[model samples]
Target: MVAAADAQNYAQKLGIIHGLVVQELGWDEDTNDDLRAEIEETIGSELLDEDSDEVMDVVLLWWRDGDGDLVDALMEVTGQLSDEGFVWVLTPKTGNSGHVDPSEIAESAPPAGFTQTSAISLGEWAGSRLVQPKAPSKQR
Candidate 1:
């Protein structure tokens, strides 16, 4: 297992590390596990458990759906973010099985009550940071 500092390093490069982070597993790979561990270290505790039912500040959405699954992904977790919270949808960069196009993300965002803010490049995936503008003040 990678050390906490390494995880934190990767997460920091990705601009993560804010309040309670909700990790929604759309990919469920070993790399995501490392990222999760790093994020937990960054925030100094275990992340919010999926069944916790609490508002989160940052959502690490690891998705591996190629074409048809983004809808389900967005629909299910869009409502889970606090008003000021943000969701980082990490998908395959391009060559991977579940690579999502940026245009596809733009088209799918608004209906889910999220705004696609920026694109991120990760070790093996691309990330789209989405935010719900109308959510209430966040806890962290």
Candidate 2:
């Protein structure tokens, strides 16, 4: 059994904290319930559903191979973020059913207006953090 302290550490690694609006997308039976619970606990509320129109501070997107066109999915979620928000793309780890190639995520993000910022192992799921590239400064 995973310790609660360890699980909380994992949630913290995703930058989740109290009062942030975290939206969840693509949840299925295969997604990690423990991790989801930890995130909800850290945020002090349940994750907002995909249909929520409120802008989000973080988007937790669960994806898999054969799910859909990742580019489109990323673009759609990007539109729902607050200016400084980001998305965490979680996919099944290697050897698991529905596992996605990391290269596929790397390629898909740029066209959707995001860049891969970091990646971390989340037990059965691997997480990639994506953020929109900062707009270039305007010269006076």
Candidate 3:
């Protein structure tokens, strides 16, 4: 898996919006005791900072070129954080030419308002579709 800083940098190159760098310590394997301790300390500091508000949204983008286990690990972590806020998974479409499709993996635990997009470019795809919550019917 790519390091959090590297992943965030790549997302910036891709022009992703509101991309916050996150380090998943559980995903690391080769780190020694000292490195693990330091990582934990860093995570704690960031999470407990007085200026840091609770996370409201998260976007987990995994490539088909990467390991499947990493995707599974991400799902596990998201499950634990579900009540905190929305979580979206952007994964590659099967049999496509490395194109990503955002879908809800768990029906019982869908993201707040999951939907399909024509393309990853936010505005390029949004205008083609009209989305609104269903209105209640008139009573007899």
Model 3 error, position 34 (Å): 32
User: Ten consecutive residues with minimal summed lDDT in candidate 2?
Assistant: 1-10
The prediction achieving the highest lDDT against the true structure is: 2
Q: Cα lDDT of model 3 overall? A: 0.32
All candidates' lDDT scores?
A: 0.70, 0.93, 0.32
Please tell me which predicted candidate would have the highest TM-score against the true structure: 2
Off by over 4 Å in 3: 1-59, 65-74, 91-97, 100-140
Model 2 shows how many backbone clashes?
0
Residue 1 displacement (Å), model 2: 20
TM-score of each: 0.75, 0.92, 0.27
Clashes of 3: 0
Q: What is the lDDT of candidate 1?
A: 0.70
- Which run of 10 residues does model 3 get worst, by summed lDDT? 123-132
Question: Least accurate stretch of 10 residues (summed lDDT) in model 1?
Answer: 23-32
